[model samples]
Target: MAPGSSAFKEVVESHPKQMNHKTLKMKAESGTVKTSMSLAEKHSIHGVHELLQCPTCAGSMYPPIHQCPNGHTLCANCKIVHKCCPTCRFELGNIRCLALEKVAESMELPCRYQSLGCQDLFPYYDKAKHEKHCPFRPYTCPYASSECCVTGDIPFLVAHLKEDHSVDMHDGCTFNHRYVKSNPHEVENATWMLTVFNCFGRQFCLHFEAFLLGTAPAYMAFVRFMGEDSDARKFNYTLEVGAFGRKLMWQGVPRSIRDSHRKVRDSQDGLIIPRNLALYFSAGSGQELKLRVTGRIWKV
Candidate 1:
């Protein structure tokens, strides 16, 4: 071979074209030198291109950057005539494009829900879509009713119930009993009688008990007493029968069989005995069944 050809042959032998091709193939397969620009670089280029586009006259735009209320970034030309965002008609505001600044700086973006589901990295603009469809989003209703058959998200269910089923909602002690007084006499004579056998001389107690169908947790037994015509004294008693009667022990009275009474000092149109008095049964008959009630009463 010629003298110059000899050096060229040596150089070619040392660094073969096949070796270079192999190295390039390995790099391509390993994805080290990507063919296309990265997502962040692409976003930066697009953002810059958009910044240069004129929104008002279809011409090129010039900075400083402004944003609409809907978060659309626009140039100064668009802000002159447009009090609102050109794209969404939202009100415009003076805002900086820190995101574009960040993109220009080459900061790495993360996948939305990286703390929830995903660990993969992504461009900042792609994060919104990822988070919108995240699988682990937590949801709960604010109004959860334990007693009724209603169950749903609180705000929606509360508004629905208020509008459509307002009458169904009631406020009171859930433990109290509701009854219509059929016999006024039974109610009037409630304070003095040992046992109110009838209401208005009618058997309303028996009917009330039967109407309850044994489902009530407690029984309400009203009793009345007749006093001589010295002064018309009235009494009302509401005996809480059954296990619930045990609560009366806190009132310094035997929850089982207790005696209590009040005397009428002044004449106030006869004594008006309050209802809701509790009574306990004595061991035997003729036990002097005292009235354990609260209210003024004249002693005969």
Candidate 2:
């Protein structure tokens, strides 16, 4: 019978009938307490999670989360390469734990990234998967592919971008940046400039590009957060373009870094200026193109 069940309670009641009545009652009560306490222990973070953790790898046991012949548990991750239990040195293999699996199912646990601001609760089976893409999770170096392996929060990422990528950093949430495409007539489509804006302790990238939209030469500009789209929606940006008393404005939530600036631009989700309009903003007699763009970002 499951511990603390009515049947188990009856078994405890059957104990020591010949002993002193008071002592006998005390024994039954102690047994009741022990079994009742097991429920709390079985579901506690410090208790069950610790028990589930592999002795060697310290990973949580999720039933074929593995076990040794003598009943010590190990996570599935630690089961391979070691033939014996690390705790008891007993031969380890094929030990099914149907009872504990039921207990694991009964408990909801926080993601491993809980310390990083994730409040999500999940069963053991879903915790790791949710954490992998959790927005609150610390970001890896945006430049990870180049082997510049550093990781931290958003502020740390901005600092890394400045120190390592040597990316241009502009001050303030509001900006009046002048983008110069010097050769407006160039047939090639391209990204002209990228500026990093620091505000609200977060980093946003301003992308300026010159491209052809359906055979119409144009320029597109937009903002994207250094994090994921889910995070980007927490804030919004406004882009403004125009010089001679007329202005075109686009305002929207910043896309996540996962969405390439080109994707945002091609989505027509930002400010777009056609060739004629772009040239009018150009200084130096239209031979060069310059647009004095003004914009601001604020938390939504």
Q: Best by TM-score, which number? A: 2
lDDT of 1 by residue, 167-206 (tens): 1222211112222222222322112111112122111110
TM-score, candidate 2, is 0.56
Ten contiguous residues minimizing lDDT sum, candidate 1: 250-259
Q: In lDDT terms, which candidate is top? A: 2
lDDT by residue for model 2 over 136-253, one digit each (tens)?
6676654313346677776787888778766567656787767665467873453455667766656778776667898988888788788766557778888888877878888888
**What lDDT is obtained when candidate 2 is compared to the true structure?**
0.65
Could you tell me how far off, in angstroms, the CA of residue 240 lies in candidate 1 after the best superposition? 99
- For each candidate in turn, the TM-score is 0.19, 0.56
Screening candidate 1 with a backbone cut-off below 3 angstroms (N, C-alpha, C), the clashing residue pairs are: 142-154, 143-154, 190-235, 191-235, 191-236, 192-224, 192-225, 193-224, 193-225, 196-223
- In candidate 1, how many Å is residue 48 off? 6.2
Clashes of each: 10, 0
Query: What lDDT score is found at residue 56 in candidate 2?
Result: 88
